[model samples]
Target: MTATGERNALDPEPIQSRLRALLDHHPDGPLPDAALRQIRTSIAPDHRSRPPSTGTLKERAQRHEAESAAARAELIESIHAVDPTPEGLLEFGRHVRRNVEPSGFASNMGAAEFAMAPGAIRAAAEHLLDTGTSLAEICIGLNLLSLAPRDGDSERIRIFIPLGRRIEGTAIKALGRIGRAGPHLAWAAERTPVYRRLGAVQAIWDLPEREFSELLYALPVKQSADLVQMFSALDSRPEGLQGDRRFARILRDAARPGALEAEPEALALAAQLWDEVRYGRCALLGFAPGEREMTTAGFQALLASPEASASVDAALAATPEDPDLVWLRMRLNRAAHSDPPLPRGLAVRVSVPRPSIATQARTHLLLDGVPLVEAHFQRGHSGRPETVLHDGRGLEALAEPRDVKIGDTGCVEECCGAFRAVISRRGGLVEWEVRDTVLKDPPTTRLTFDADQYDAEVVRAAADFDWEWPARRAARLLRERIGAESELMSRWECELAWTGSWSPDRSEMQYSFYYPKRPSGNDAYVQFSAARDVPYVPEVDDGAVMAVVDRIIADLRTTDPKSTARLSGGSREYAEALGFPWPP
Candidate 1:
């Protein structure tokens, strides 16, 4: 019987008799066999020695509580041993597993241990960063090192790349489910130097030659030029270029001509770049008053130094001029215009007369005296608006972001372009895109379309567009041009520096900086899938490519009756129709 039961039984007796019997122990049992058995059980060695049944609610709960306390204590103690404190939990865990796991103790420690000491982990990271200490030494010293975890051999692998100025080889090695392109690369980008250099080069190498040319001028002149040479050696070959033609052209621009009559060739090179230009910034050379096009005057200034012999102007003006340069200049000028130049921020309204047929609608966005984004828009009718009543009849009460339409059709136009698209049940969406980067803004400029206003015919004069580069377009062209795998890798170096990240899902019909994430800074890679085929891009001057993209963008932006020719948004269809050789 329980102590309570015994007490209750005693209470049933008279107070005097119960007290006397409890004190004497003789009257309590009364010598009955059953009573004797109960007494014997209470005092028996076997029964006394047995553990408590623990079946009662309080006893069971107490047992569980004791066990839980023990578990918590173990976890806390374990955490204190390996990581006495913690700041970044996952990072701390990584450090501990990497440094401490080799010792015999850490493997034995439980999860609660990791949960206990947050400060210790932070200390470890600081120590790791500050002291060039070996993690293995720390683990062994802490008595945490031991054999690897059961499956750790399969799940984990070491990375050998160094960052900053100290690192040597940085080839990414594959492990488990992760490829050589490890996730650590993403994290390394923040703290490691190895990745930053690779990423910068990746951005530019992938773009077109003209943009790359402009990019060189924008890059830290010395450092940027060195990177460009490295890229040339790696990507393509040109005159005196060890790699290929694109890099050769870049090197040619970077060079200061030797003394004598090299003036004409230098001027020719300048003209080629000026005509084919695309995207790039020239903060390196300072600014220009007009749209910074290369001119004969500029050429004269460059070649007028004391070392130069013969009049640069006379050599260039010689009747038997370099036919190759002349042809290049002509081609670039033609590429610079659309049927009519695009207009920017110029909104006009016209309801679809049929309200169902889709026609090409166009617009231009201007920036820095140039049309930036231009394309055909799709237009359609919008539905009527309404409002929700307070009555909880139609809508659910728990839902968020309440939606209601009101019955009003205001003529107010939104900054959001709803008028660009005139949709129908039959045709699909048509959007504006940057086909060329050369046209002056406000869409249809008299200068952009007035072929008669030019001092010379298209074939004779170098295009008047700015020759500065745009890196993104260069990347597109490079990817299209080179067939070599290694060259392909280097193409993105410049582009990555400009755009920040890379994306493979580019639309053939559309062109823009189409990265997967809006980068804090660009990260271009030289690798591509084996199945992809990069088209052959030509070796036109960097300025000429820019001029072409610009002209094409501007020329496609108008709906005027004067439209004689236009480049299509789906450039492939246009190319097929025109049968013109694509710019490599």
Candidate 2:
């Protein structure tokens, strides 16, 4: 019962009765809309209201896992104690069918545990797998085979692989576990639907390169999204498909003229393939040169078809700003103009796009006026925008001889993806080599720039901030005025810092001298804000803000003698003074 004296929705008996009543009324067809609404309303509130436990989510999860472990141990012990007879095994299968829900938690015995089981028990499991009519018994048998994989059981498991969705995944897993299942797994990958072929593709990675290449070519292309997982699996292999002529031939065939028609799915796949080559996935760079040009030409041929082009244009007209569609349109425009291929020169330039409500100030890197990062990396999935160097020391940092993050997923929290490069100077040349990356199988990208040209470009980019927002201007002026080793810095124990405003229309220019080691709830820093309309020129507005900061800090010091002492003292004294009240 709930606190309101109403029946708890989680009470399975009542919920089951309600479901039975509904099913009886609509026995052979879909339920009416009203019936569906009734069903939802009956259970949604209680499910929402019930917290798993009166503890933090982490604590609750830990407790549940511990309980599950204890339960599994007890069940395993009980199974070990069961009599080792044909009758006993049959009774155990019956017990499982009666008590176990197909989707519910159950103890799965591992290889070592099954090895310790009586020989009679293992024989019974195989017998159940061979002839059991019950889905539960078959699923149990499949799991046992996978854990204690036997070469002899491979053929038996293969029979169940194509049976149905109910046990197909389990059967596939078991077959993959047995020795020498690569050929069978590859066959399955070719026959299964694209969505269900991930496991099969992963299992066949150890196959010979020729066989793997044949498998990839034989699989039918459906939607572009379907190929992402397949390409990902290929990229994850240690040796990769580098310099394999068979794989190169496969790519060449795929890129051949008139191979891909003007269908929407084909066009999307073309774009994905182009992206794959650009990002260097699947060891694409190991292939002969000019394959990229051939692929692009193939995609362009599809675009040249009047009917296909019209369809894509109509889609864009209806949903003009869909990122993927927009990206496709951009690529088409570039292709139509025959934009010069990625420049192989030493010159570097930075391009800044106008700011908008949805996007903040971003900078794009260009080599000889051709976009570098934009042409290479994928913009992350929807809602998470592509990351680029923003207004900061990001560009200047590139000049240093260290691995620097050139781009990333547009996340300020934990990074989901990043592209990094090592910049080094050797003699008269500056080398930019891809060191670590988020790409699956990125191509080798190493470029050498004349040392003088590279240094000049870095200096030019860092100094040229004509696109700075008012907040950026304010922060820059503050940092300049309050020198790195100023008395103000020592007193406040902070450095001048600012992250530009996210909003474009209304700039809340915030400048702060932040204390690096301030305690929680201790607002021990000085902050200033400027509005969008404020004068952005450093010479015009710098003096006024600096004056205000000086006055405020002077007032704070005079009023809080103890706080000043704590700030000046060493770590031990600061620790001793933590609990006492301090002036802001």
Leading candidate by lDDT: 2
- Model 2 per-residue lDDT tens digits across residues 166-274: 4556766666555456556654444443334545555566566676555556654432123332543232332444445545455556656666666544555555555
Model 1: per-residue Cα lDDT at residue 267 = 35
RMSD of 1: 32.1
Give candidate 2's error at residue 46 in angstroms: 14
Q: Pairing residues by index, what is the TM-score of model 2?
A: 0.45
Q: In model 1, what lDDT does residue 164 have?
A: 18
Per-residue lDDT of model 1, residues 469-541, tens digit only: 1232444443343322322223322111111002122111122221121234433212111111122122335
Off by over 4 Å in 2: 1-172, 175-201, 204-214, 221-229, 232-238, 303-307, 314-330, 345-388, 395-403, 407-428, 431-447, 451-584
lDDT, residue 366, candidate 1: 27
Residue 57 CA displacement from its true place in model 2, Å: 18
Q: Give the count of colliding residue pairs in each prediction.
A: 94, 1
**Best candidate, TM-score-wise?**
2
Question: How many Å off is the CA of 186 in candidate 1?
Answer: 16
TM-score of each model, in listed order: 0.21, 0.45
